[model samples]
Target chain A: MTAAPHPGRTRRTVVLAALLALLAVAMLAGVGLGAVPVGPADIVRAIGRALAGEARVPGDAVIVDIRLPRVVLAALVGACLASAGVLYQALFRNPLADPYILGMSAGAGLGAVIALTLTASATALRFGVVPAGAFLGAVLTIVFVVRLASLRGALDVTSLLLAGVAISYVLSAMTSFVMVFFRESMTSVVFWMMGGLTAASWPYVWMVTPMLLAGIAVPLLSTRELNLMLLGEDRAAELGVDVERFKRVILAAGAVLVAAAVAVSGLIGFVGLMTPHMVRLALGPDHRVLLPASALGGAVVMVLADLVARTVLAPVEIPVGIVTALVGGPFFVWLLVRRNGHR
Target chain B: MSVRLAYEAATVGYPGVEVVSSARLRVAAGEVVGLIGPNGAGKSTLLRAVTGSARISDGEVTLSGRSLAGLTPRERARRVGVVPQQVSATFSFTAREFVLMGRHPHLGRLQQLSAADTSLAEEVMARTDTLRLAEEPVDTLSGGDLQRLALAQALAQEPEVLLLDEATSHLDLNHRMQVLDLVRELADAGMAVLAVFHDLDLAARYSDRLAVVAGGALGEAAPPPAVLTAGMLSEVFRVRAVVGADPVTGAVSVTPVLREEAVPAAGLGSVLVIGGSGTAAALMRRLHLAGYAVSAGALNRGDVDQAVAAALGLEHVALPAFGEVDPRAEAAVARMAATADAVVVADVPFGRANLGNLRALAEVAPRVVFADGFRGERDFSGGEAARLAEGLAAAGALSVPGDIDSVLAALERFTAR
Candidate 1:
């Protein structure tokens, strides 16, 4: 057996480095451009002073207390959704499959709507219970979808997608029923569904950061295993993937990541779907580079989109989800249409 | 030598219905076993039973004398590899990454490929001649390339036992040879191989032993010549396919008497075809479907002509399998040929084994026709068969292509008289 060295090794590494640099630029832009116009020099000085044990530097409150938590939460949630997106795409062996294709978003939306209305008076309950309900709803929906999708020891794509779609509609209708009966809490519910990072505090950021890290770490370990799945589940099993066990574990891991992201950011639409799909198309589907690159790309995209949400039409905030959709929707359709034309 | 993979009286099934029943076969280290049978005859089911993919309801399948039932799939995969017909890919994976995944069973969770593992995958890619295409995306690969890549992945596993289900069916002539050569090399390297093949000739050329599955069970395992008898193919495929040795390579070759499924839509009345070796295989099929109740005579048993005759269900008096043209069989064939309204001597090779078929055709000369273009080529019996064919031609017998339209016209002429 000869080494037969990988010719693209150095080229891929260089590409990765460039992506990281882009992420850094995007993060800086996210922090620098805002309604108050905190320049890069002022932000640098504030960071330097804060490192030197000065908490009262110029723009210190805006940089540290107000905007910093939101920025960090945005990065963590983006990482969570993108990594989860990679896992879901690999698990189902479908390029079009996304994190929420299996009813995760629909289930979470139902839970958020319920929890928002139930605890209008209890502010602490709103913080904890809404995320908790969303997570529970996501887990339940996925479990049901898995059960309903598999037949005679095989998962049929048509059945899985159909089941997910049907379950989503039923759960959404139930959420709508609750909303119609209780109009008083509709405004908060709608705001949560629209999705934002504005409510991100230090506590909320800390609560989900560990979950996001787990999401990123688990897929990193299974990069090769996930690559095995691209060749279909039976082939993966023959190649020693313990395919049934792998499916369960990967799906659970992906759902956990989705729970953390949706719980924090409400329902940011396209970070999970667009980031991984676009990255795989541009770069090959080697999950080793893909996992980390997507993590960075997701983080970069989320941070930049949040900045737009923060500054656009100053003082009257639009949801970050709307911006991502407005960007992803047309681009996704164009990619598909162009691919079809080429074929 | 001890067997690495052995199935004993195994009845594999889905739910309650058995697909392969009571099959007994073995593959020792350094042996290649070719699995051949008609479609749905359980060749694949037998292979699947080894990996627990199919239920082995009534028999034992052991890897190195231990049942695979006790071993986990990963443990089993560590020792056995499968190359299925089509490997569907959902992503645009490079061929190298896809082949490297064959090492998964040998590594631990969270373990990267060791330098040794990478070397093995490289060796496998080189062996499959896929190194040049290693960086190509699998989704964009041609069928042959993807098939070769699948084989390379199986080889990268470096397992003691390998199972290939129609692995080379989609490959071009060059890649087909490459894959079969690689299979031989792997066998010589002490790997056991069980390959399901539709091409009997290729199977016989490569396999150390041939396992003929038929009638819901595997027949006796033996050398290719011993197991690939005309009787077996006739019973299994319901096609009269003759088995003979290649003139050059000397490998056993199985030629189905009639390969084309294009059974003629129009049925001519009955017509007689004089066939031997593989001369009348196509003619028999054409005559049968073009509305003639097709029959042929003096065909040696276990020959291509006999097999095709059997496959087409045409009534023909066949000689004994691989022996002399006995008086009783020759007389019966002559009688049948003589009584026919018209006989067409297919442009078959004239050898000592089938000189009697020509003699029978000579008896029906006034009613006989010869297929065009082999006017003098088939004279292996010194020219005795040729002289007889020329004498019949001198008697005003027709000579034509024996194609569907031509044969139908000849049948029409015979019926008109």
Candidate 2:
């Protein structure tokens, strides 16, 4: 059944529409602020010629081939991370939970590093090997964490986070122990963990978009069950929710989402933790609105962060993760100190 | 009417520990059954067993004669609704939104609540007096309001059987009566209601029958008068109490005479009182509350003294009000007089019709206290009452000032025997 509007949906509609508009402007600014400073008219003509299947204009190769792919890839990764955040938060029933709070990012990073160090080259079939290992490692770690955190049909929130942190420390130690043998791969691993969108290309965009769609779709379809779960698990069961199966499906979807984002961009922090929270504070915690709002907010924040990452230092190229942390950390602290609880 | 819910020879437990063993009870439509026991007496466990939260290791628990184990949760929910003892939640949903969840079992898996389902929720909320609280967050409401909301949600199920476990534990007097009245109204509407109550008096007042859980077993289910006997109350609850009839509703009532509050301190023994008007009513209550085995008699039935006796649960021997004094009633009074350790004759002036009461006092021997004026009014009907009074005084009956305090002193002096 369709949801009737709840408490000021008009304002939320205005907020969402503004986020999309801001994202459009940020994308244009990102494309326009390069070494050549491609103008709006240049972007329009380049796009017109490219879509018309005609010969490229002068700046067509720069805008259509280079910047657009990078922006699209950043949007996809951002949407995936934030959408996964909502799923994990609901699954654990903890507002502090995030996509990688349960060590999915650390496991994914370890998987990518192991693949990189073992291979003779980190390029050919590199994407396939690393993403598959990362996805497998992330999913397996989630399963183990879930088992450790559950007691007699209920999940314990404190134990789930503790298990995740414990596993993360051990996995990071294992990665380091292996890294001592391969110094060249170790440098690439560190570079990857810093996280950036500079490797943006059409292939990377193709790699993350489908997963982004999947991550958003899973929560969209299960919003009702998610609402049922907001009351404790037993109450949900008494009301006829198959809680175990619901948990498994949502957990797996969240693992895939974090695994996909981390595989390509390596451990981008704060977007998954902060985007959903910001959206939840602005709109209420109705997952129907909150999930999509988080996705859109994630996309906007990631694109703007990327815009700053590529341009602010002028060709030096800061990692997008650093830019996100620089913005998100202060805002997060402000939220915690300024507000007592949800109004 | 057919039984809507039944537990037959059921043994419910967790792991190796049995909580409710060999329980046999049935609740039929249009009945409210109260389950009561002392703390740790498995009252909640028996309730949980019925709800399927605990395992029924043996025998049968049925809903409408069909085994509960065979039905799906949603199917069972459609028939039985539980008003849980407490609900704690993190999401701040409004009361209306929370109450709407009761319709979940009736809705299709993917279908949302229809207009009809919503209107039904509104109706139940209004019935529970929670309509004004519809917009308030559930967590922000007071305990009583939350309880009302819980009732609304349970009623929204339109269930045939309702289970309540200590549902009134957190309520005050007004809300407690309101909740019991609601349960009665629901039962009257062809629903079976089983409630767990810690307040035995409240249970006795509202329940058609009571099932006592004690020593890990369920006692027989019987009407309040039979189940609330003083012997059973002391054995099951370890409290010294008197079982009486409610003056207004004629329901069973319990007056606990706490051991620390009474006879042990005063050293009073069993005292029987002869009272007709309202004169000895207060004295009878004071002696009974002081933990004496107190009984009053010789008052006409349906008179002030009899009504007071019924209210205080002070057992009394009564004659038909304003009728010829019957030999059978006199015989009953004489029989009760045989067991009295002491008897106090009230300051009532004797008439020909009531001459049997003073005559009955002849049977109480060791000590009898006559009020002061019995000698002055002893000349009625050629001094016949006067003759009975002098015989009592000759039998070592002490005369008091005929006031409340002096009569109590006279009774205390008799108790010293």
Candidate 3:
């Protein structure tokens, strides 16, 4: 154990480099593999003209207007989901904890259903109503759960999980009621709940990007504080950490990021839970490196999962959530089996 | 020379609960004070209060006339270093890294370590002899090693006052002596070191002053000789003992009295226990507890077994420091064994010291030696016992067995008249 170049740090840097390369390749592949297949040379020419302000190629408009925005949005949302996952893991100290583990997705889904009902009567729900409603729902659910768990002036992870479970059931029930009540918007509500990039657009990306960046940055800065906290709240206090204040700040920032990602992408499962844990196994528990590594890893996992969802069946796209859940469920099972076997 | 730390009618405990109420005591610098008491006497709590970890309910804890509340944790670290009893590491840091963390208070947030700070840490490690295990994980080290590591870490901070709770309970004889020597050395170097020790002999040996904490308050703190008295030990520890000193070093060693156990009378045998101080206490207790009529001579007072004989009201002939064994003491041992069936000698250290006493006892009775005598180990009193055993065995009057159990087993085989 000759201290392997701060193994965690080295692994993280290598993983980050590999992820950047993967993202570049995925961007190229995403542009070239559609029904009207565009060659890389032609796409390169189109991209150059777009950069040089001289685009008049025949199919250039479709490629730039249609395909590029969707792929770009896929990458952005993928990065957002992954970064949110890392933040949630640090806040919960549980490798299995993700943003939706707190029931935010169920809350957001219920909000989307309500927005669909409002849009039936008026079109005010068109531009930002869906994401805005989802964001509000997520924030409200987080506040409720946090308040419920902070009854004794100290927050406990178990109580928070229990509160999240309770709210998730409540919201899921309400979402089902809206689904049955408005069968006309059943297709749209169903797609939103299953999670997809079918509605991915430049405007949606702009709306969620700021919240996502802030969310990632805030958790990254608090990485040192998080390291102290892994020893438990009381011990952390003895070492000069103001635990209550730190907890409040982390929870609020983590909630904002989770809410924004949920608002835009609906409920993309596993991206948040799986990426952070995989990073931790390679990186050790120092949040300083763990947080940034998780963010990069999460982005890579989400982007790849989205690629498979869009291309595996080609013309007929699969719901991105189905692919993630299929992957994450078995990964989680293996983790549990290995952990129990060791014990 | 005098730095005072004390409690003035102070009550201390957790939030809204008082474990120790109205404790009063004054501990002066340059005086190594000990706090001893029964369990739940709030001794640990008092230590916490002094370190500003626990809140004082009523009065304040002051150091050199300044309230402890006025000092920041960094200021306290600079002046007072505390070694908590239940020390555990959450993360596996190397011994050196753990020690370096003690230097946190001295350095500012962005300040790089100066050469002086680095050298100070090295010096403390060398002084504590923990530098050899500097790169080993704190979790993997043995108890003695961990204790030394803890002391080194506390010393690295270079504090003026050191507070240790049960620091030496895990050490062996050599380590105990080593740690105590370091404590005294530090104290002599003008750092006030207050340590808690369970070993009565150790506390009496190194501490200039001892204070007992019992019933949630501090008892009288005074010099070891004055504090570790016979009456005080009997009252404090709930055991009877004759308190005396080692003739070689003048350090206090107690002889405890064991309660007598009723045994059926067997053949009469006069047994002489020839063993060093405390080792004989267990044998004497076992012998007396079995209800065998027993007597011993040249046995030191304050030895645990001497106290056992006194408590059992046995016929014990003891040697006094003030005078030699008179005609009556020797004559009494002979008279008591005149009609006895057998004689057993324990593994007593034959000192150039106790040679005459051994010679006197060998003159009478069929001597049964404790088996350890023939092992030919280094003799405490030269080779007198080894030579005497040969002569007595040649005469067919002495028998040697392996251990305490074997000697007692052989004694039971001889039928009483």
**TM-scores of all predicted structures:** 0.85, 0.76, 0.69
RMSD of 2: 6.1
Q: RMSD per prediction, one decimal?
A: 4.6, 6.1, 7.3
> Candidate 3 versus the native: TM-score?
0.69
- Tell me which residue pairs clash in candidate 2: none
Off by over 4 Å in 3: A1-190, A231-235, A341-343, B1-12, B15-17, B22-280, B288-319, B322-417
Better model by lDDT: candidate 1 vs candidate 2: 1
Which structure among the candidates has the greatest DockQ? 1
Model 1 TM-score on a 0 to 1 scale: 0.85
Docking class of 1: medium
| Model 2 lDDT, residue B32, Cα | 94
lDDT by residue (tens digit), candidate 1, A1-343: 2354554466668878987898777766777778777777777787678779876855787886777778878888888888888888788776556656677877877877777778878988876887777777887888888789985467777687778778878887888798888888877666766778888788888878877777667778888788888887768777877777878788777777888888878777768778998788788788888888888888888998998898888888899989988997787667668757965
Off by over 4 Å in 2: A1-26, A29-53, A115-129, A139-167, A327-343, B2-18, B22-25, B40-42, B45-73, B259-417
lDDT string for model 2 (B56-146, tens) is 9999899999998888767877888777777665666778878887887787656766778878988999888888888777868877787
The full ranking of all candidates by TM-score, starting with the best, is 1, 2, 3
Model 1 Cα lDDT, one tens digit per residue, B111-190: 76777887788789998999988778788888888988898898888789999999998899988998999889889989
Cα deviation at A60, candidate 1, in Å, is 2.3
Candidate 3 C-alpha lDDT tens digits along B296-398 = 5555565555555565455667766423446666566555554445555666555565555455555553554544554456356567766766665665555
In CAPRI terms, model 3 is classed as: incorrect
Model 2 chain A is weakest, by summed lDDT over 10 consecutive residues, at: A1-10
Candidate 1 wrong stretches, greater than 4 Å: A1-21, A44-58, A116-128, A145-169, A182-184, B8-18, B21-23, B49-60, B214-216, B259-338, B342-417
Candidate DockQ scores, in order: 0.51, 0.26, 0.13
